[model samples]
Target: MSGKFLPTARFLLIVSLLSSALAVTPSAGAQAEPALQTHDVPVAGGPSGEAAQRLADRLGRSHTAGIYLDRTEHRFVITATDERTAEAVENAGAIPRRVTYDTAYLDSIKKRLDTNFKTPGTMWGIDVLANRVVVRADSTVGKKDFAALKKFLAPYGSAARVIRVGGKTERTSSAINGGDYIENGVVSCSYGFTVRKKTDPTYKAILTAGHCTITSGTDWRKSDGTYIGYTTGHNFSNGNDFGLIRAYNSSVTYYGNVEAEGGTAQDISYSRDSRLYETVCASGYKSKYACNSVGLKNQTINYTDGSQVTGMDVAFICRDHGDSGGPLFAGDAALGLLSGSNNSACYSYYQPVNEALAWYGMEVF
Candidate 1:
């Protein structure tokens, strides 16, 4: 972690759960779906997002139960609950599909709906081409709490479904001072990458958004106040959000680049895994650089403060409220952090910079 002047350094874009600004009125002679607006017939080679996450981590998690891409036959469907893992996912190029539910049975029905659903405007993930466990719910979720959440999943029928969707999942903080973002002056978030210490390479750090170092504590400043790092470790909740600041200012200096759009800076170089429809891009201190794709992956997010995270990864891109721990890229790899957003259908949500650099073993700088 060395640098090239951070001066006003900014990063953050967390804001997801559901932010669809209430507009579900289409029943009167509806008719929408002009093929959801075309575009998706571009298949050619397909696997790259680190070679489809190294063929879904070399087909592990009991024979891969998830992997997306398929943008109108672009390729990489994966799923495979058996048939010998769909012949090792079509011999590792990806196209599988088989599915009945694996990936440890949809991660044990998302850990029994994250241990008896906390339900705050609700949320849930794992679609793996619809293998199950969707959930969603919003509009403040109250039809008797969506019918006791469909009678507590009616014992996992069809593995789980539910559905409703339309805004109402919030958690946005702001204070971040340092000319523009990276704040611990109180509660500001976003600044995700510039790490070290795969066994102590003089240990440096920054990766953000485990609810912003558990609600902005663990000292971390920058806008002239200096100080730069501390939250040594963090994980927002059961599904995980991510954190780990540690840098401790060795006279502050850190760079690998990232912060692009106009003021320029991009070069990250490594970190992948997140490839359902590919194309990502994020950077925030209030929705800075934007670009989208990768609609869902692993995902689980269930917050309204009932707090519950889980391998998140969705993207439509929009982010706001100081974009919590920003940076979710594509050009120079490095793939996630922006941990949440919806700002009326902006739909971001992240956390997977190689599983927070392998749960803080760290890397990237």
Candidate 2:
């Protein structure tokens, strides 16, 4: 079911129920934070989280601009433009708050900035909670460029906010690695989700980081240097960093499961859009499977080397080298592909799996 069909009240009840069901004990290694307070709402069950996400997407497509799942309250809080939109949200069983800027306007602001300022150290995207477009510049943003960007966006007024993000964002690529390692020469990276072309289900391919494929014609190999496939499609620039490897060995088996930290495999049933405050897990060669809470959505990251990637999601999950191209999942749903991380490895960004699938016309196996 899509988000449009869920009643706001029923959605909250369902969320509350699911949250209770899936509540996990904090792993000893998990850094604990204070629990967020919940809204005073009666709990009940109605739809799944995926259904709530669909409703959110539907609202997002309408006059409503932004939506975030309040995990503590077990409900979605929506931002709308008018009384009519608010009423509509109430009718759909969501909590609606009136906001001045809709998502379209915020997205337009981002587009305009992208067109006017190709500054390498800066990135911008819609921040749903603030109901505004947020532009972040890393330490590498020179004084001249930062000032120029500020001047360019000044006319946008309060519609945008510029902030400084510490450390440089760089592509996560190095040797280490276990989601089944794929090696090219001496370089090693983890395999992402296995996929099949929409037009030919029998045609198998593996998804990975495009930066890993920068050296064209480099045949991908197994850990022992056995031939596996070659990089078929890649896009490390122009806003995305995903690559596809067409596997020649039809006998190569890829299950719809992710190997967790303890060698157990978790089944992947589907793919869904990520929401703020939601719990997610990642599996990489270096870090294995680690679960963490998602903190941001629709973010843009600027690399120190001057490359910029937009439409990314961030989480307070640990990652390291050889983690790029790994999978980021929520329950059984595929969410994103590991892209890059900040200087601390404590936080990482992902390329949404939906975008990559749409771009490649492929589906997870």
The positional error of residue 267 in candidate 2, measured at the CA in angstroms, is: 1.6
Residue range 299-326, candidate 1, lDDT tens digits: 6676676776677787766676777888
Error of 2 at 325 (Å): 0.8
RMSD (Cα, Å) for all candidates, in order, is: 19.1, 7.4
Least lDDT summed over 10 consecutive residues: which range in candidate 1? 5-14
Deviation of model 1 at 94, angstroms: 9.9
Q: lDDT of each structure?
A: 0.67, 0.70
